[model samples]
Target: MTSTGEGPSATGSSSISANTSQISLADQFARSTEEEIQFALDEIRNENDKLEKETGILTKYLKRVDPKDIQTQIKGLEASPVQQDVVRVHKRRSRSRTGSTERLLKLTTEQKCDIAQREHDELREEINKFKHETEKILDTYRATREEAEIRLAEMKKSSYEFNRDIVLGAKNLRTGRVVAERVTRYFEDKMRSRKALIEKLRLKNSTLKVQKKKLQLQLKQKEEMGEVLHEVDFKQLRIENNQYLEKIDERNQELLKLKHSSGNTLQVLNTYKKKLNNLTMESNRLKLEISQRNELLTKIDKETELVEKEREKAESINANLRRQLQDYIVPEVLDYVQVRADLYELTKTMKTWERKVDIAQMELQKYQKQWLMMREHNRTVNPWATMEQHAAL
Candidate 1:
């Protein structure tokens, strides 16, 4: 029996050891998983950094080639006269005078060589410029490709991280669920006790809810009663206010009557004031007319003096005219005709000035009438007058 028990116990011990080993192995695997994820993240960061450095260097190299230099070289090549041909004609006549022979003079060998050398230099510069530009373009394209690759790698790394996080979270959730299940299994007695307590709490909550509902109903009833009371009070207050307002209205009616009477008195006073002002204005106008009459008398005195002088001048002119008539000059008739035409033009100018004055006076009278009508309308609809009535009330 001892041997049999030992054998069974040994088997049990082996099983326990195996289980411990499995747990350790799982722990090691989890640690390795975390380390591998960290390693992957680091590798991605290092790769990204390397790609960025390379891209930066390539971009700098591309920027070093100036496109303006290439354009300037092209322009210089186009402007070079050596690229164009000019023809010159030479004529030679023999001493025998048979005819003229025309020959075209071409550029000399040295000149042609110089032009070719210049052309070669221009072509070389253009070619070199184009080569540099092409290299710059290629460098840019390569840098762009590298940047895109780097970005793609970064996106892949982020995707991997996201997937890893989801996996880790799921694992943690599963572990939590296992732990929770183990705790529930270990505390079955306590769970029953807690269940009873929860049931009691649920019953208590239900009862409390019913009590709260009853309280709410009571509160609603109280609120309704309070609202009814408030309404009754509001109605009573409104009735009282209405009675007071009626009395006030009666007083206001009396006040309005007084105000109307006062307004009538003010209107009468204003009318008397206006009449007094009109009388004063008439007196002032009369004074002004007297002053104007005096000025006119002075003007008349000056005109009399002027007319006297003009008459003397006319008499002298008449004497000269009579003398001229006696001389019997036909040119004198032309002078008399021009004098008559000038007098007619002066008379027409005076008539035009008089017509303009009459038109201006008519326009002024129309404006005055419009202004007076607008004033009367404003007095009837003035907001200030209404405000004053309200204030008095």
Candidate 2:
């Protein structure tokens, strides 16, 4: 019996081929993924740089549009009550509002970065999803390849057995033909499925390429818009310069008005000076009166001191008399005097209490009379109650 075992060289060659194909596939996937990621990063960085440059340019342009001097002039002009120029104030307010609106419309670097970052995150998530999907597909393909390898091994064994059987005249030619047909049909279906999968991958790749192109175009358009914005900034600056010149002129007119008013102010100052001189004369007279009043107050204070001393002497005499009355008087006499005083106070308090009691009694009698009248009215209104009261009596 002849052995149909595969040679070592043939097995090694097949394994080598399989390893090389797998390495090529892995390398292609890695290169493609890296290129896409690098491309996206480069695009994002370029956009960021452009946005920074534009933001800086805009900020500088806005700074140049109106200087501090112009704003100060406008503020001073607005505050000039002498000129109450409503038109100028309104114009300034409107300009300020417009400038604020323009500033609001201009995106800051941080804001631009936030939008870019959001887009980047979304794109990154999409890339991650695509990578996950690709990995899943690759895993499925790997599993399918393993299954096919196993099936091939089974087929090889079956084919060897079939060939051996044929050589021994055990298997018929019709059976071999049926086995060959089944193998051909299985390979044809596998090829068709693989071709469809490849076509789908190609379609997806083409769509991604188109999307990338669209993104590139959008970036270009954004750069062009930045240029247009710069131009608009220049135009706006020019307009603002003109407005500033107009404001300077208005300020000069206000200065002229102020100069004219300064003359009137000088005349008013002279009148104020004259009044101040009169007030000084009046103040000197008042100062003299104040001095006279101060002298009179000193004299009154001296008299008050003499009166206070006399009052002190009188208080001392009274205090001495009170001490004599307390110490020299007999205890019985003192007690009689104290009792008499207490009796008098008690009688006064009793008289007040009696008056209160009399007023209270009179109020009570009035209330009683009102109650009697109310009861009589009730009895007259309700004759049945009156009859019941009489029956109870």
User: What tens-digit string does per-residue lDDT give for candidate 2 at 1-393?
Assistant: 001122456556666787999998678667787778678679889988986765554443334334455457667775332112322332343445432122112344464455445456766888999999999999999999999999999789867765564444343476644454555655577679779989999999999999999999988998978744576789999999999999999999999999999999999999999999999999999999999999999999999999999999999999999998888945588899999999999999999999999999999999999999999899889999889989999
Candidates' lDDT values, in order?
0.69, 0.72
- Model 2 TM-score on a 0 to 1 scale: 0.20
Which stretch of 10 consecutive residues in model 1 shows the poorest summed lDDT? 87-96
Task: Give one digit per residue, the lDDT tens place, for model 1 in 1-393.
Answer: 000112345556667787999998678667787778688679889988965654443333225424455456557866333222211111111221332222223444554555445556766888999999999999999999999999999779766754554434334564543344444443575568679989999999999999999999988998978743666788999999999999999999999999999999999999999999999999999999999999999999999999999999999999999998899856588798998999999999999999999999999999999999987787688979866877999
What is candidate 2's CA lDDT for residue 303? 100
What C-alpha lDDT, on a 0 to 100 scale, does residue 99 get in candidate 1? Answer: 20
Worst 10 residues of 2 by lDDT: 97-106
Q: Cα-based RMSD of the predictions, in order?
A: 53.9, 42.8
Clashing pairs for model 2 are: none
> Residue 50: error of model 2 in Å?
1.4
lDDT of 2: 0.72
